[model samples]
Target: MSTDEDLDRLIEILPKSIQHIIETHQYKQSLVEIVMDLGRRPEARFLTHPEYLSAKLISWQDLDYSTKRLSKFTDDNRAGIERTLHRISCIRNRQGLVIGLTCRVGRAMYGTINGIRDLLESGKSFLILGCPGVGKTTMVREIARVLANEMEKRVVIIDTSNEIAGDSDVPHFGIGRARRMQVSRTDLQHKVMIEAVENHMPEVIIIDEIGTELESSAAKTIAERGVQLIGTAHGNSLGSLVKNPVLSDLVGGVQHVIISDEEARRRGTQKSILERKGPPVFYSALELNDRFCWIVHEHVDRSVDMLLQGLEPRFQIRRFDPESRLSISLQKVDSSSTSSKGKAMKSNKNWRKNSRTPF
Candidate 1:
């Protein structure tokens, strides 16, 4: 089915008044979220427009009409369409009464990351970093599908918020054959990561939101055991993550090292220097510039070292073409090709095309 048909399934849950208004959208496929706030006009949001879907202010009946068609809200005030990626987050008042809903449409946009297929196929653990809405979760899902269904690897997803997989017992078809391990609460992500390894015996463990020190330590444990790790961390760039003490372990935690005075002079640096303390839990990382582009650091240990030394790290610039075909450009530092880079992507051939995006 086309994306239009998928949009229909999501729109089906809205009240009749709002559904009539949404189906008229010229760019329904580009719709991002549908907003319905108590005592405010319902809206259908897209990439650029906040279009009013209904002229009338929403009432309790309107809200209930939509809620009745969906799953019950969880402790986190979130819900989703069964077996679909669309997410519905709730906004409650001080009394904990639902006041608004943000129904976010999720897509199984395949092939969006064809530009980074080489990185996915490399077999080393890699981390993706980007701001929200840049398709980190989307990319992770597609990679899980490729690894499990196509490459025949045993894969498991540590789905914390039900974003990686959909909100159902049956895993979304988008994930192919990969098994998913749902996290009951946010604080227990680290424990679940460990359990995924000890109990499941998966060849690859895909996780989302590596935010805490405990989670990063769990990631390190999994990587050390030679189980391939592919996940998203919270940082826009490698430099930001290194300074973030909680998440620094994903790129190999930083430490203060005391160098000999004589050695310091030889290196033309201060005696006290910061160095990566251990092998990075992730072999590489990619910084998403947008849905269509990313700046990649192919080597995690070397990238962290360069940042600690006050040297700008080189990057592999990747972009998707008008045809959704991926291309790679190497950004050289100091006019020398020998500078270190994020995954040194060689070419964009042999990327099997399926789905609408790499995400």
Candidate 2:
């Protein structure tokens, strides 16, 4: 189904008053979410800004009206519309009552991964990093479709919150031929990740939100077993992942080693220095600054090593326009440049399109 039709289903579950406002809004197609809080005016959030849907404050009846029409909220205080990508997360009070709702609109954006099509064909694992709502899940969804349907690879998705495959017993068509294993509980996601590999014998494993240490360890185990992985974790960039103790394992992990005085002198570094513990689970990592802009670290181990050494690592900046035109350029980071937050990216536009392999 089209995104518009899927959006209509989400609107239908809203209270009548807010629904009318959204149905008549000019920019309804770009709606991001609808925020409904108890005793406050309901709001409709778009891509750019948010607008109040009604002046009337929300009441218990209004909240109940919407909740009753949707699926039961999970242990994570989240729920979704059946067979659609839309997600609804609730905010609870101290008494365990749902006081607010964040109705996030999820769309199946095709061609979202066109910029990185070549990397997908390489069959190497990828770890995508970005802030919330930067289209991480959406990118992985399209990746699953392309790999499973087009590349004919055995793909399995670890859908923890049903955000990737939608909240349904049967997986959504957005994922194409890829199979999905729904996680019964959020904490059990790591267990399910292992289960997907052991039971399904998939060639590619796509996971969303590898947040915990156990999940990170599970990802390492899967990668060591030779299965390709495509997953997302919470962080803005690879640097953040390296600094995050819990998720550092995803990028080979970081540890402090006490080297001998002679070795430290030869290396021109402190006696106690940080170094990569082992090989990275992922072969590449992409930082999604925006839906159209991404910083690609093609070699995860090398990039992590450079960061640990306090040196700037070279990377590629890929940008895609609305026309689906991809432009690739090399970005050289200067270690001495502190004005741009200790790093500066010099774009070299001499990159050729035909030089790279096609997916």
Candidate 3:
């Protein structure tokens, strides 16, 4: 029989359940293997009928555990099994497309894609946070691809561990048209960042796993120059990121962050900075709170630029202020706080309240 005939015969004889697995999961089993298994049963010879033969045997190594389990389902219960498989397949496909993954396994992956798109579209520096195995490196490479191909931006990747660029001794083929700077050590991260900016004239500089103090500082310098920066950090929550003085410094300026909860779960914790994007400002919540939270200003010392006293300031400090109004300067509490200062706002309840509204 032709291959198509074989497939049709198998689909017809098998219970609805097993057929469903084959259809949805794209399950393929070797005909020879099934024939061999059936040959062991002497009575199977009497069942020369193609329909009987197809129903009698099944084998596929590719199917996952659940799909494999469904293959053994009997005719009596096959309908219910098929329905279950069908539902899973639909949900998996839906999520895969939405999140940009081959299957549902790629949900976290798709988030990274969206995050990268955000960076390219918004032209902002960002961070991808995850301990490992949450597709951080893969996502970084894809970002490089999108930036280089679609946006036509000059992109450079600082591949430290070879994950982002792959291990071909040359830049991998998947990163689109970006340039690759393969570094054997992390010490070169800062130097590479600078070289990429000054020499390469890259519109976007991509790096993998920013860990050391030097690397962090270099990232800040690059961002300060107005060149877009993107990097990954190893941690679950934003708080953990702040713990590393250098990473905290580097991340302090990031405007948007995307996190992968799966990485946090794998590491027995619940945090990771999977993705970050910004215009070199707005790091974390506490950083934002300290720098620009709207609070009621019950008191203020005009002579000294400081909060006088009040029931916790109601108006948050704003990054900008009307030049004519009373000047309120908000300084970076730390290197991470975006330099959101003002000269026209002050410690006044009405002013603070009004400051929240962008003038």
Q: Rate the local accuracy (lDDT) of all candidates.
A: 0.80, 0.87, 0.44
Per-candidate TM-scores read 0.88, 0.92, 0.42
lDDT of 3 at 337: 23
> Lowest-scoring 10 consecutive residues by lDDT in candidate 2?
343-352
Q: Give candidate 1 regions above 4 Å deviation.
A: 332-359
Clashes of each: 11, 0, 26
Which pairs of residues collide in candidate 2?
A: none
RMSD of each: 8.3, 7.3, 20.0
TM-score, prediction 3: 0.42
Candidate 2 — which residues are off by over 4 angstroms?
337-359
| Tens-digit per-residue lDDT, 66-130, candidate 3 | 34433332221221122111101211234331111011111111223541243367786666555
Candidates 1 and 3 compared by lDDT, better number: 1
Task: Find the candidate with the highest TM-score and give its number.
Answer: 2
- Candidate 2 lDDT tens digits, 229-339: 999997878877876778888999877678899988886665776778989999999999787789999999988887676677879999887787889898866645512
